[model samples]
Target: MSKFLLSALFGAAVALSSSAFAADQTLAEFHADMGGCESCHADGASASADGAFEFEQCQSCHGSLAEMDDKHKAHDGMMMCQDCHVTHEMNVGQKPTCDACHDDGRQ
Candidate 1:
């Protein structure tokens, strides 16, 4: 292969590898960005300690799930709270809209 082709392949490989690594992010990394462990793990409780996430805890900050669900009823089944919000620091505005998957003009 020509040097140019080899370099292009190397660049593409690196990009793909980096994306893969990003997809495997640890919760700790998310905690760091979204605020320290206590931000979500209130009262010194550990999320890993129980392996459970109480949606109620989030509702304390983000509002009731029922209300949010009502607002998002149109995109139901397309995504869930975790699909877009991996952490408490998630900016809802940046989350993918229903159009991302429902953009086939089926609506």
Candidate 2:
């Protein structure tokens, strides 16, 4: 291939990759759009002290672990937020249901 054609292809590839990266928002962005950082951070300035926003942190706002346990007791509470909300972007309808992770035989 000509040098010019090769350069064009490389440029296009870079642009596509960068756009994909940009599409994923940062944690701070999610906090701003959703609510005050304290909702998840506990103390925004000292987040590390509290803990990184993992499944437990998400549970604070979405629902209590106990609530989930009660609701999903039949399924043995074998689901996690990540199973549905694949990314922090968290769009509705993008999430999967119990059936997605559980077997068809599950009650």
List model 1 lDDT by residue over 50-107, tens digit each.
Answer: 4335334454444544457564664354544554465544442345455545667642
Best by lDDT: 2
Error of 1 at 45 (Å): 9.2
| Candidate 1 error regions (>4 Å) | 1-35, 42-54, 73-80, 88-93, 99-107
Query: Global lDDT of each model?
Result: 0.50, 0.51
Which digits, one per residue and each the tens of the lDDT, describe model 2 over residues 16-106?
5676433346544544444556545555544444243645666654464456654444433555555456534554334345565567854
Runs in model 2 with CA error above 4 Å? 1-32, 36-52, 69-71, 74-79, 93-95, 105-107
lDDT computed for candidate 1: 0.50
Q: How many clashing pairs per prediction, in order?
A: 0, 0
Least accurate stretch of 10 residues (summed lDDT) in model 2? Answer: 87-96
Q: For candidate 1, which ten residues in a row score worst on lDDT?
A: 88-97
Q: List the pairs of residues colliding in candidate 1.
A: none
